[model samples]
Target: MSLRIVPVSFHEACSFVDEWHRHHRAPQGHKFSIGAANEADELVGVAIIGRPVARPLDDRLTLEVTRMATNGTPNACSLLYGAAWRAAKALGYRRLVTYLQAEESGVSLRAVQWKIVAHLPPRRGWSTGCRPRTARGTDNVARTRWEARIAT
Candidate 1:
């Protein structure tokens, strides 16, 4: 399978994600989006990179893979992960981070040399009396945080 990296508009990437993602819909926004295309020029996977959702992790030097979805193409996730990091590093980001559902195996991350940085326990939705928000279906599902850092 010849996979090549391609630039994708956020809206186009989100549309592919909506059609293929298992647990979540497309994220609200991204700094950039990358796509993996086969020899036929069909996009098979996408990675949405953006500022970290958690305030503490929103340091200027860090960016997060807000969402990644693929059409089950072999090696597509690993390719996207690697491409995203290279793009982020080229833009002067020191670190790239992402999260996986706890039940998911970190095969793609491991392939790209992303380290397990933290195991995040599930919480009630981010909603608070001070900032009301809708509870998402992922409310009770734990997640694992992973990181790929540029060598200093």
Candidate 2:
């Protein structure tokens, strides 16, 4: 089956992620979003791009794939990742990044030439006595951060 990129509103993208993401909920906000559709014009995947979660990395020139979800479509995830980077670059962004649970093989990322640049240790949920938050963390698992290379 073939796939194509389609324009997706943030709300639509979030809704897709909320329904299909394996272990996380939709993000709070995004700079933009992309959709992958099948020949029938049905949305099969989505990728939400937003500011970097790490405050220090929120350099305006950089954008992050805050979330991605697919209905188990082959190559859909990789296509969305590649499309997200191209879209970001077209909008004049210098970098596109994403974080994934360490257990994830990142085959999709590797297929598109995105390389792991950092390893983030597991963390307790972003909660504290001063500002208690929900425990919907990444299951307290470590993560690997990836970045797309500049195309030649």
Q: Which lDDT values do the candidates have, in the order given? A: 0.95, 0.92
Structure candidate 2, residue pairs in collision: none
Per-residue lDDT of model 2, residues 9-122, tens digit only: 999999999899988899999999999999999999999999999899998899999999999999999999999998999999999999989999999999999999999998
Instruction: Name the weakest run of 10 consecutive residues (lDDT summed) in model 1.
Output: 132-141
Predicted structure 1: lDDT = 0.95
Candidate 1: residue pairs that collide: none
- Candidate 1's TM-score reads 0.96
Quick one: best lDDT, which candidate? 1
Worst 10 residues of 2 by lDDT: 131-140
